[model samples]
Target: MPLRVHDTRRREKVDFTTMNPGVVNMYVCGVTVYDLCHLGHARCYLAFDLIHRWLEKSGYDVNYVQNFTDIDDKIIIRANETGEDWRELVENNIATYYRDMDALNILRADKYPRCTEFVDDMISITADLIEKGNAYAADDGVYFSVESAPEKYGLLTGQNIDAVRSGAGGRVDGTGSGKRDHKDFALWKAAKPGEPTWESPWGPGRPGWHIECTAMSMDSFGEQFDIHGGGHDLLFPHHEAEIFQGECHTGCSPVVHHWLHNGFVNIDGEKMSKSLGNFWTISDILEKVDPYVLRLSLINAHYRSPIDMNEQLLKDAEKNHTRLMGVYKAALELMGINCPPLPEGDITSQVPLVKSLGLLEKMAQGFAIAMDDDFNSREACAKVLGALREMSRMLGILEGDDLGAYAQHCVEWLEDTAGSVLGVLPTREQTLVEPEEDPRRAEIAQQVEELISRRSSARTAKDWPAADAIREELTALGVVVTDTTEGPIWDLL
Candidate 1:
């Protein structure tokens, strides 16, 4: 398959004929470990997770690498506030990140390089840049000579570099005495009192934020790779700097074949932040709703479109997710009866639940087409839901008999191809916690209610032993029964 991906350099679609046949090397910017993962991070990572799954399904050998910015200012500040070691802070957050990713069913990357671990590599790259006259060190720190690089610095973002150069003057944290221009960004920061530092030729210090990625990417994926992805916010100075570092050192343009960026997520018409009090932690939301609801809400919007995070959107997404699962179950049941026997050398034994092999196959095709058309997950998801609704009505998995043997076979294939391969499913076993009011829950509630009523009656009748036994049994089952002015009520333990 000839994949067409959006090339940020050209600001247009580009054909992805690989430099090495059937092999794709992808690098994505990962979370800075200052805080817990949020929905915004979910959107960015899940989008690429889907891409990774699709590439593998299409028979491409993919080498996916993501990095941890474990040495950023945020991590330092967080550690200082808690009086903990900076490395400890990052390690704890990294552990939390893995748990969240596992819960979401996002696959692990082939390599998870931490910025601190690659300090030597970063030093080498910075030295190379200095030797090539693309960077310089000052009394404060080393900085990249942005103007020394090629004039195509703004090509990827389609912004004129000169137009924005003036306002950028105030943004530089430290004034690098050797910097020829205000737009020059730091390559390394000189170690300060009580800050993390490593020995380097330039002095004792650490790699700057942008330089870490450039060095790590070069070390892991070499001079060029198939794809580079991150949030849209990184497109301007960060990505431009990365391109500059790669090209100035290696004398190559278009260091990456494709660039992908997911749009920002907004909460209540504003970007999420600590100041807004609307910033939600993944752990916080997990307590209130299942993770799949969060995943569905993120993927429902186009990966490049700004998502307005609101309760209405999530409620609708949850309903859609439930309806989709219900439909898939129904379709499987229908296939059992209606599907024909598979001939030899066939992939599926049953007729596809939808006109396609399964609703997912059609969705997968549509998803590829949308992604090819600039990663439009919104349109692709709409088409998938439509097919799901149609097939669900025919199959009756939600409220019908066991799927026929043939339908079961088709369901397994489609579920694996779509759910496992694409990272989109109505219900994953890990995220599918029983609802508070599920029938089983209700049954337990009813039994508890009956027990409370019986206990009340038993107490009134002076049968103290029966009442005590009922209360103990209910308590043992995680029901804290209590009597109140209104009536008896229970709370889940």
Candidate 2:
């Protein structure tokens, strides 16, 4: 199936077609660098990361650019409260952003243009808007004239512009600034007492939040790009303002081809908020949960569906991660391949594993179908985990070269699909490492082997009751025995 995506503006799933074939110029709205990233931020970025991976996997050279709002009201507030320089505060928070994203295994964008870097471009755009009669300068700053382009008002949010104009929905209001209409938003803010300032045609002041994205994205990818993605919360005033500014300034009707927005991350069935005591920073969550498990938990739901994050969700993710990795490690050991500390290099260079197993091929096909359908990672992840479970059950029955080759095929399939696309599996070395050695390892191994021997004998004699009793005893000892065509094999649970 061809790639299909849910376009936020059209409110429908359409075939994803880039302006230039085999190339995707994608821009994702990034975090404002004032504080550490939270779960909502993680969810947004992870959704894009999955898209990035799949795009590249499907043979598209994706030029992904994500910008940072380095200069913002929140940064200024945080700096003043902490008695730190605003620049220093922005730098520190950016560093923490990288640390958190790296922990989640999110791929970095090609360019991270800070809003401060594009101040000159922002001035030019704001000035052009004024010259073209799309914006007007006021005592406070320049503001976009929503009246000039009334049609673009509800392109993204689907609000009734007539109702908003009539003040029927309580949507229209004044900002108390020197602006003509309440629907009009600021293009630039006038200089304040101690806030950061830049020389602009409007005055010596910083750019507004919405204008920063417009300047940075256009500067990176020109007047038009393929995709613009952000959180659902940005679907309103933030993104709507971008549309008005970009199209009005450049005379380009659609600045972006496809608009994508990920759903919110709710905590325990409630919106995550500091006042509600449910807010969780990425660092705090990583401290308690494994990063791989956290990635699974975040992407387990469709990107357009709200994820209710709680202890139970995380525990379930951990269990799934454990089961998937357990089979993967066992397969590598059977193949006599010791996984190095890093990922196996260049999956494409390796020869495709022969499709001798029907289950493996079915998994590959099912995974592709799920991912093709609007990057349905939730379903894709389910297919991977379910297939691995089946492979684990088949591990013990075969022996010698057949077993070894089958194991090798399973490992390669996993590395190609789950590791490459989902980003859920860990490196080979991480899977093989144990946190601590069991103190009674030798005694337990011996006991398990003896019990397996008895169980094998009972089964050979057709004494099902004796074999079942011995199996229960093994379970009590934290051991699981799989009866294969060759014999019953046991492993520590």
Candidate 3:
């Protein structure tokens, strides 16, 4: 099947008929960067990366954009709590987010625009709204007239706009910003003391939470684009607001061709939250497990399905990741020794293995079909995994010259599709860093080395308790010692 994906707009499977054939303009909402990224953030971005990768593999040139909400209420609050400048906090966390995502092999977006940096564009858009009589400035700030747009403003969230208006009206009638309807959201907020401010047409203040996305997206991707994606939670007021603002700003029928929302990463059966104390920072999990394993586990379930975060699930993900890698390695080896040239005339016997390319092609086709059919990543992932397993049996072993060659092909294919296109895979260097150990730490390393030698002697002599005690001591010192078929190898955990 051609690149069919379920467009959330129509609520049906449709081919991703790009406005321009062979070129796709894709955009996804990125992190706000006030805090460390959580598992929920990881799943959303990773799913897009896969889509980006697969598209590139399937021969479409994708121009990807992910924006950062740097200047927001959360950032300001986080900055004050930590005694750091708000902008500095945003920059720091954004850097950290990049590092974690990079380690997980997620590709950097082609453009990562920040809200604060695009103040002028925001002013221009806000001015357009007021000029069109769709917005008005009040005593405290400027608000978008939700009533001016229409009563059907809650189409995205499927909630009643009138109910939302009546409920929000009584809460904060600060300084008499007379909104025609209670559902009218802010476009600009009047500057509060000690908060960041930009020179706007309304006054020196920041863009409102929802307005940032509309302004930045229009500035970067034009009035309409192929896809707009974010967390499921944003489907309501956030996304709905964007649609209303965009359509008002530009006389467009649909602000986005497709709307894709990934499901939440729940902890246990409940939603993860700070109060619940079940939220896992992506970086925190990275320290305890292979980052790829976390990603694999995230992908094991369909992207749209809720993922429960648990220790048992993580452990299974690690094992499953290793198995997938092993299979990929095996396939590469087999293809290296016996596979024919790409786009070449081939003979028989290798058909089952070589023809497995057709299976992979089918899986790719199925992936597109499922994706077009409501972004069904669950079924698409199954196809990819199934094809990977079938091709593995054709290889003689997971390592050797043949395996290496086959691996190179698969890696190249993945790089072109998953890395370049999807923006999912990080670079494969294996080594993370070359460090300068502290002198005292170096001395401790030596002591650990000596202790390990003694432990090896104990193990040789079958002194089980002594060996176990020494191993435990080493582990306490932040050392991880592994016993491979080649014997013990030690490293700082």
lDDT of 2: 0.88
lDDT (C-alpha, whole model) for all candidates: 0.77, 0.88, 0.74
The digit string of per-residue lDDT tens for model 2 on 109-165 reads 999999999999999999999999999999989989999999898998899888887
How accurate locally is residue 335 in candidate 1, as Cα lDDT from 0 to 100?
A: 53
Candidate with top lDDT is 2
Q: Name the 10 consecutive residues with the lowest summed lDDT in model 3.
A: 340-349
Candidate 3 lDDT, 1-493, residue by residue in tens: 5666656657766767877779888878888999999888998988887777667666888888899999888888989999998878988998999998887777777999988888788788889999998999986678888778784476676777666666785654563655555678898888999998987777788888888888878887788888888888898788888887889989786878888778789887889998999888988888888877787777767666788978888888767566655654443334455443443212232544346445556666665666555445567556656655754554544345535555556655444433353333444443223446766567687788898899999999999999999999999998878887887877776
Clashes of 2: 0
Candidate 2, run of 10 with poorest lDDT: 339-348
Q: What is the lDDT of residue 318 in candidate 3?
A: 69
- TM-score-based ranking, best first? 2, 1, 3
lDDT of 1 at 194: 89
Candidate 2: where are CA atoms >4 Å away? 168-174, 336-356, 434-493
Better of 1 and 2 by TM-score: 2
